[model samples]
Target: MQVTKTALKRIVLNRLYDHLRTHYSVSLSRATFVNAEPEAHAVDAATAFRSDIEIEELQRALDRIDEGAYGTCIHCNAELPLEDIRKDPCKRICRGCEKFVF
Candidate 1:
């Protein structure tokens, strides 16, 4: 079944909120591990860092949706295929941009 843009927006919002919650929990756990287990603390810190980045990206995606640019490439302004967006809501660049960057 093809997903409507509204549905895709909802999915992306849900995922963003979920990630925010996960990031908070990871941060709490990281704080606890700071003095108890150095290795675990480092791992949790890294996870929290990555989660923070993802949260930012998802927020930008939400903003793009509000601006009617959710499925458009940020670099080339190309319309991103729905399948690609479905696979990764945080994607902001088209395949062409990806190739150009690499």
Candidate 2:
């Protein structure tokens, strides 16, 4: 409820766009770069792994949006700051719980 309807819409759109971009990156890295040189392949694999993580986060964000819990931390249930949401709409935990998560 902290975010206005208009802002929620914008956040959703941004998350969706980021999801698409990250998915494409993962696909490209796995397919086209899989047969590259040894060092390049390692880097591409790492990039793809990071992209996979991002894809998961984006999906969770969409799910939380659908459930009307987008701007709240899943860990502590604290209302996430609007600025934090603006920076990373897919964030699931607040800064406080973030330390323990990783």
The best candidate in terms of lDDT: 1
Candidate 1: pairs in clash: none
Q: Write the per-residue lDDT of candidate 1 for residues 1-102, one digit (tens) a residue.
A: 355555666666556545655655544432333233212444335345564677667657756776677787889888888778867989879998999887
Distance from true location, Cα of 21 in model 2, Å = 5.6
Against the true structure, candidate 2 reaches a TM-score of 0.54
Write the residue-wise lDDT of candidate 2 on 17-98 in tens digits. Answer: 4455555543343333323332355433544445466655655665566667778888889988877887887766899999
How does each model score on lDDT? 0.62, 0.59
Best-fitting candidate, measured by TM-score? 1
Q: List the residue pairs that clash in candidate 2.
A: none
The runs of at least 3 residues in candidate 1 whose Cα sits more than 4 Å from the true structure, single-residue gaps closed, are 1-5, 25-51
TM-score of each: 0.59, 0.54
